[model samples]
Target: MLIDPHLLAVFTVTTIVALVTPGPDMLFVLGCGVRGGARAGLLATVGVITGDALYIAAAAGGLAVLLTAFPVVFTALRIVGGAYLIYLGVQMIRNRKKGQTDDPAAGGMSGRRAFLNGMVSSMANPQTFTFMVAFLPQFIDPAAGPIWLQFLVLGAILIVLEFVADGTVGVLAGRIGGWLRARQAVRRRIDAATGSVFIALGIRLAAER
Candidate 1:
C-alpha cells in the first residue's frame, strides 16, 4: 500500500470532520446553488474539485518546499486571495437587488459563470495549498511505495470525499432556493446571508497566520 492503512483511516475521519465544518468552499457552493440552481451547484463542485486536483499536483511537485523557502510569497498570496474574496462578497451584497427577478434566466448566474467562480475562488485561497502541504504528508509511508504516487492516491481520496459532501450541500440548497424563489424577500435574505458568509470567510482567512 502506498499509504499506511492506519494513517489512511485517520485521515479519512479527519477529512470528514473538516468537511462537515462549514468553510469557505462549502459556503461558496451553497451561495452558487441558491443563486443559480442544481446544475450550477454541481458544476461549481466540479470546478472546485479541479482546483484541488491542481493543488495536489503542485504539492506533489515540491511547491510546499518553495513556499517554505519563501514565506513572504505565501503571505503575499494569502493577502491577495483574501482581498479577492472580500471583493466578491461585496459585489454579491451590492447586487442583491438585481437578483430579485422572477425569471431564473434573468436573475440567476449562468452555469458557466458558476463553474468559473468556484474554480477561481478555490484557486485564490492560498490556504488550500497550505493545508494540502501540511496535511497530506502525515499519511505517507516511504516504505509503502513512491511518495508521489502516495500523494496522488491520498489526493484522489480527498477529492472524492469533498465531492460527496459539497455536492450534497449544493443540491439541497438549490432545491430549497427553488422552492423559495417565489418570495422576493426570501431571495434578498438569501443573497445577504450568502454574501455575509463570504465576507466573514475572507476576514477569517486574512486574519489567520
Candidate 2:
C-alpha cells in the first residue's frame, strides 16, 4: 500500500505491455468471444484473473522458489503447457473453417468450461509463476511495509488491467463478429493466423531454458 511513484510507474508500464501481448490467455479469450459471445469471453477473463491472482500470491509468498528448485517439475510444466497451447491452436483453426454458428458442440462450451480453460492454461505455465516472482519484488520497498501487502496491491492492478484489456477485446469481437461471419474465407485466414501464433508460442516455450 505504501507504493513509491517510480515503482508504481514501472509496474503500470510492465503490466500494460504484458496485457497487450498476445499469449495463450489473450488467444483463449479472443476465441471465446469470436465463437461464443461477450458472456463467454468475460467468464474466461474471470478464470484468467483468478489464475493470475493465484500465481501472484504464490510468487509473493515465495512458493515459486520451491517449484523452480526442482528442474524436472519446471521441464514437465513447460511440456504440458506447450502441448496445451498446440491443442488450443488446432481447435481454433478447425473452428475457423466451420460453417455453423449454432453448433451444439460450440454451444456446449459452458461458462464453467471457458473459465476452467483459462485457469488451467495459465496455471500450467511455469514461466508465469517465475515471471511473477522475479518481476514483482523489484518494485517493492522493504522499508515501507509488509511485502504481502505490496504484492496484493500490485497483483490487483495487474488483474484490473487484464480484465479491462480482455473485456475490450470481447466487446470488439462482438461488434466485428457480424462482419467476420459474413466472410468465410477471411475467417479461415484469421483462424490459420491464430493457429500459427499459438504454434509459435508453443515451440518457443518448449525450447526455453
Winning candidate number (TM-score): 1
Worst 10 residues of 2 by lDDT: 100-109
Models 1 onward score TM values of: 0.89, 0.78
lDDT at 198 for candidate 1? 71
Considering only N, C-alpha and C atoms within 3 Å, which residue pairs clash in candidate 2? none
Off by over 4 Å in 2: 91-109, 182-200
User: Clash pairs of candidate 1?
Assistant: none
Q: lDDT for model 2, please.
A: 0.73
lDDT of candidate 1 over 1-209, digit per residue (tens)? 56777999999999999888987889889988886777788888888888889889988887778877997887776677667767777887898788466664346667897787787667667667767888898888888898889999999999999999999988988888887655777777777777787787677667767
Candidate 2 local lDDT, 1-209, one digit each (tens):
49998889988998899889877677767766665556667887888789889988877787777877876886887778778777877777776656545432332235786687677667766556766888888888989998889988998998999999987886576456535644556556656765676666666666667
Clashes of 1: 0
The local distance difference test score of each candidate is 0.80, 0.73
